[model samples]
Target: MLSLQLIRDKKEFVAERLSIKNFDAANLLNEITALDKTRRATQSELDELLSKANQLTKSIGQLYKAGARDKAEAAKSRSAELKEQTKVLSAKLSETVELLNKKLVELPNIPHESVPAGHSDADNETVYEEGEMPTLPEDALPHWELATKYQIIDFDLGSKVTGAGFPFYRGQGARLQRALINFFLDEAIDAGYLEYQPPLLINEDSGFGTGQLPDKEGQMYFANEDNLYLIPTAEVPITNIYRNVILKETDFPIKNVAYSNCFRREAGSYGKDVRGLNRLHQFDKVEIVQIEHPDNSYATLETMKEYVANLLRKLELPFRILRLCGGDLSFTSALTFDFETYSGAQKRWLEVSSVSNFESYQANRMKLRFKDKNGKMQLAHTLNGSALALPRIVASLLENNQTPEGIKIPKALQRYTGFDLIK
Candidate 1:
């Protein structure tokens, strides 16, 4: 949620920036301003009426003490009328506030000034590219084919047990998945992030706190009976840990990491791209979240981006980083850098991680604040990224590292996997 005060002070500026996100803010902003004005006016009237009522009560007491019963009765009657008026004004104020909040939540976070103006991913700017594209033999198979050849991942078996997009990882595939999770978690801990094992199920407020409620409603799996949502990412649960919290200046750089089984209802998704380990209903991801002082948030973003890049580098995979154009950026992020790894068989870059600086967007919604050196409480900046999502990373690893002998595991992950190759 945006700060109403910021909107009031910079309506035009805010509206203009929102345009970069492809949001039409003119009508919404106008309605919010009108509603806010009515709410404030109603509140002011209620305050004045209450003040008058207090004065009338004082006069009534004085008159009654002096034995002027008639004057006291008249003041009492006026005070009763003021009470009724306040009741009506209070209802109006509540209605206006509700309407104002509805419109406010509809507005997405404004794009940062550095964000490129574009319509889609095609227009995203390539900020960095590293490693080298692996040279594979023409006979090299896609990850799915390789999985079947090695009897690693069984999609048909999974469908029989559950449904599509719920493939069963067998033997080495399952072990490799576990290995990746542990490796990512260990990397995060080494980077000074406190690891958390947050509940996989969250309430509605927790969903809304991370800006995943109304915006991505259809994309989440809800347990209707309990009204709890299966987390779409560890980011949702881990970041909400600080919801409604106020921190001191000394807690400037709060970092946390979690590995979770993310569930998503990819409602309209279809086609070849969702093949193999590309997309799934449930997947494992290691998420890194940070709450930083506003002054240091961007620096923190750089550190995070480097951390993710280093992970890919250690895996010896070819990768590139894209500075997401406004239209391609997530709703809660002001600026985002997406890391994509090349899948040799697919001949395309697969997004393995997205590091973003929400710049108080999520913090504002979560009510996560900090007291700065000047003694003023302000929204802290919140950021999160996939230290790496396993499925796609596995897909790239299999495709890019494929050899005539078998699928070779990267040296960095060999110790965790217990074996060097899935032959």
Candidate 2:
């Protein structure tokens, strides 16, 4: 969605930035630029022909009025020739524009200056840690095993009824899930995020508005019968509410929070990491989205990090924050921070949230612009984060708070759960 003019002006800079993501943007930029030039040239030529045709028509009308029927007829033939030329040029312009747009969709967002260069999660840097990693009892087992003994989560039933990675919560496990969702939503509201109940399915425009189409299409469940796709995240529907909208400067920073059950295909994923509540085809999450002035977006990123960190603190779980490397970053995010909680029984850290600043990348695609103080329209910055994801958070809480008597509920959610312990 980058303006070709912007690409023309900052080609080298953008190329260098994308290099961090191992993306060579130079060739694509050149191709886009050439296509733009070709489209523009075709348009200009077509406009000239139309202008000539209009003039000829006017002359023909005057000739007809003057009883010069032969002259009028000659001009009509010339106009027909011009019309055919316009048609050909119009088709070429359309074809070139389409190709250029396809290339634009393939390009990832330019990395921010501070982003570290690397590929994959292995390159991500640990930027912060909170609380001590707790030692588990010698007999501690992973959350999946504990759920079996406690008769809380019924994975086999979920598989039989639906599919893998969709576990049915039973007894206190269901209560805990509901409690965490309520707690997270309440926290988000306290932070000034207006709650939104967005739809769980979206049309094609909604998907493209959030950059989910043209690339991640296979990662979503397509309901071809209705021409809709099941939402992969709340951000898709919630943020797309502003698509094609023009706002006054004061309308930002627009903040919204929503909870949704996300559906993902996870087409090629499997194995150990997909175990238990790790990777799932369906999961619950509370999401926060913000629209801000471009100048303040990076600053807002820090505030978001603190907000999610506070959430983990309220739950009394050990967590750490990692700055995603270029390779590990999402296609549209310029920068990202992921939070992971230590699962004592599992003897590992489980990712619970990821906060990202998309800068103007998404805004451009959405056509979400705001008038600056001077009344000039500009792209707004967009950011979103998972305040908390259910499965892993449930995993971490169940494993970390386990005791022989029962599972201890975090003090913050005790009232919501209606009990301090689940025996």
Candidate 3:
């Protein structure tokens, strides 16, 4: 959410920036302006009423002290009338404030100046590419086939026990999954991120804090009995740790990382796109989050991008980074960079991670603030990226590393997996 002050003071400027995001803010802007006016008017009236009531009380006390019994009785009557008026005005003020908040949350974050004005992933800008595309044997199999060949992953077993998209790892496949999780966490820790293991089930407030509620409510798995939603990413719980917190200038850069089994409904998913490890209901991921001063945030975003790139390099995967256009950007992100790895057998680039800088959108929603050098409170910029998402990375590794003999594991992960190849 953007600050209400920004909307009111620079209505036209804000509306123009939102246009870059393909958001027609004309009606919503008008709606917000009107609601804010009503809220202010109601509050003014309530304040005046309270002031009058207090004066009446003082008059009643004076009358009683002077022994003017008749005057005191009349003053008491006026005081009662003012008290009733106050209650009515207070209710109106509350109603107006609530309506104002509803309108505010409907507005998406303002796009950064660098955000390209366009629609869809096709309009995204490719900012970086690295590594060579591997030349695989003609007999090389896609990840699902390779999984079957090596007896690593069991999709059929998962379907029988829990339905599709919930895969069961067998023997070496299970070990490989564990190894990937540990490796990702180790890498994040080495980059100075504090590790956290957050709750898989989060309450409504936590969801709203991360902008996952309202807009994306249907995308998450809801636990109806407890009214909690299963986390779609570790980013939710980990970022919400600083909700409603205020920090000093010394805490300029707050970094955290978490490993979790994420769940999503992925409703309406079908066909080859969702096949095998391409998409899944349950998947493993290591997430990195940061809270930083506004002046340092963009620099920190670049650092995070490089860190994720390093991971791909170590894994020896051919990868590229795309700067997402407004349409493809997440609702809460001001700027986003998506990392895609080339899946050799699939002959397509699969998205493996998205790193984003939210500016102050999420911080405004969660009240995550810090005191500046001037000792004034300001909203901190928030950012989170997948250090690595397991499924697609696993798919790329299996597809690209396949040989007639076996699938060769990257040397960096050999110690973790306890084997150089899955035969």
lDDT of 1 by residue, 45-159 (tens): 8899888888898999999999999988988888899989988888888888888888888889988899998889999999999998889888889999999999999989988
Model 2 misplacement above 4 A? 58-72
- The lDDT for every candidate, in the order shown, is 0.92, 0.91, 0.94
Return the clash pairs for model 2, or none: none
lDDT of 2 by residue, 241-333 (tens): 999999888887789999999999999999987899988999999999999999999999999999999999999999999999899888999
- Which lDDT tens digits does candidate 3 get at residues 1-423? 989999999999989988888899989999999989988898888999999999989988898899999999998988899999999989988888888888899999998889998889999999999999989877778999989989999999999999999999888889899999999999999989999999999999999999998789999999899999999999999999999999998997899999999999999999998899999999999999999999999999999999999999999999999999988888889999999999999899999999999999999999999999899999999999998999999999999998877889999999899998899
Q: Which of the two candidates, 1 or 3, achieves a greater TM-score against the reference?
A: 3
**Comparing 1 and 2 by lDDT, which wins?**
1
- lDDT (Cα, 0-100) at 95 in candidate 2: 93
Task: Give the clash count for each candidate.
Answer: 0, 0, 0
What residue runs in model 1 are displaced by over 4 Å at the alpha carbon? 54-76
In terms of lDDT, model 1 sits at 0.92
